[model samples]
Target: MNPSITGFDYQRVTVAEDVALNVAVGGSGSPIVLLHGFPQTHLMWRHVAADLAADHTVICPDLRGYGASDKPAGTVPDAYAKRTMAADIVALARELGHDRFALAGHDRGALVAIRAGLDHPGAVTHLASLDVLPTLDMWDVLHGVTAAVGFHLFLMAQPPGLPEELIGAAPDAFFGHFLDIWTRDPEAIPAEVRAAYLRACREAVPSIVADYRASAGVDVAHDRADRAAGNQLRMPVTVLQQDWGAALGFDAAGIWRAWAPDLEHRTVSCGHFMAEEAPAETVKALRDLLAR
Candidate 1:
């Protein structure tokens, strides 16, 4: 039930001793790694990856704990930290013979891309982030009543047992909720692809929760350290968001500016799932960022 992204060859590459990533690679020329977000697989980038593959070598991988990737159920909160996830991406690209490449991430993947750009400046030529704020800013923005929009964040942030138990109780309903609400058009994601996402998520519950759990714990600590050290993305960065700041009363661009000195922050008129909801615009934004 993979997305209808033809012409790409899939492979399982070991990025770490205990972890391997399921990757989809296509096309030629300079490489660009595309990372998918929550409740979805690399299939989420079918369209954008396909388009980018026409010119660049598009490397799309299911971030470590999601999709068909290796999901080690470690109790440590740092298990799924962006730093670890970001290292996974870098290792995957290097395994595929890409020492340096342009990187774009959507949702949770965007968080990873931000970390990659910051942590591996010389290795990432360009960086693009869609529909997400940095980890520290994300937690800060979710303070008080505005946090209601991301109840899943709070739920997943809790200690292991309950969240996993509750989500696993009705895996389809839990994952489908985000898929249904996050997209602007219900029909944007084909029913079969939706089914695939649900199936994968259902099978990867523990790994998935661990991924979110790391955000509240280790991810925040890493962000705070980076912030204190004044470590911003050294590459040209482009951030495309749904203008949540307007509704939530936080300055999205201003927040991102603190983490990325050379940044182009713009708002997209789409839902949280920008790549699927607005592929053309998403592709254009990535192209602009790559050219930088």
Candidate 2:
């Protein structure tokens, strides 16, 4: 059986036609939806969700084309676009009877949450992103040797068949590479959870690639349009990220401030998988965001 968030009730909430998200929801009070990043499932939020559940109604869901969620064919660019994924999240919350709620995400999920905050500002009461730049700025800052770190982004962004075939050929190596490197503390993700992440990624290669591919193309276009329109995340926004600025040669918080006016940008000392490696700090930051 698949590992799930402990103390949370699991269900399939229909977010869109032919796309129902696998969600684990718990606790009660004001609602907050937590989204997981790449190469993992809602289970990535297991630790943070449990703590947040003590007071807030925490909802954790596998984004479309991820985990146990419905994987509609990514036959078109828009299929896996962050916009569509964000819509799925908004609908998921509505189905669970929440019209407005605090939203947070890590990595890929952070991309979705950013899109949601831009597209559905009225519905996303508070917004927080963990360890990722917005799509447009992400592409803008990556240059020269610094871009080497994002090799997977370029590989997966290829037209279609080739990237899928290449990754599918060695799914474990491709996905496990991130799982191993991005994490600081191996024990943070016990063997079972690591196994679960690998299993899910191995099974969802095409959709996962599609998700990244969209980020390279349509997602960038959407972010560009939003920036051009002077659209920004109006809600209280908190960003928790490693101090990639010093190494990557860009002010991470400065870039985030361009998109979020009311922003609290923080740099974490932990690894990329901050939620897992430092759940206490993650929870504290989230609680602070909610309080604002």
Number of the top-ranking candidate, with lDDT as the measure: 2
How much lDDT does each candidate structure score? Answer: 0.90, 0.94
Question: How many clashing pairs does model 1 include?
Answer: 0
The residue-by-residue lDDT of candidate 1 on 1-292, one tens digit each, is: 4664689998999998889899999999999999999989999999898898889999999998898999987577677889999999999999999899999998999999988988899999999998899988988888788889999999998887999999999999999999988888988889899999999999999989998889898989989999999888989999999878999998999988888889999899988888988999999999988888
How would you encode candidate 2's per-residue C-alpha lDDT over 17-86 as one tens digit per residue? 8899999999999999999999899999988999999999999999999999999999988999999999
User: How do the predictions measure up, each by TM-score?
Assistant: 0.98, 0.99
**Residue pairs with clashing backbones, model 2:** none
CA displacement after TM-score superposition, residue 141 of candidate 1 (Å): 0.9
Q: Relative to the unseen true structure, what is the C-alpha lDDT of residue 116 in candidate 2, on a scale of 0 to 100?
A: 97
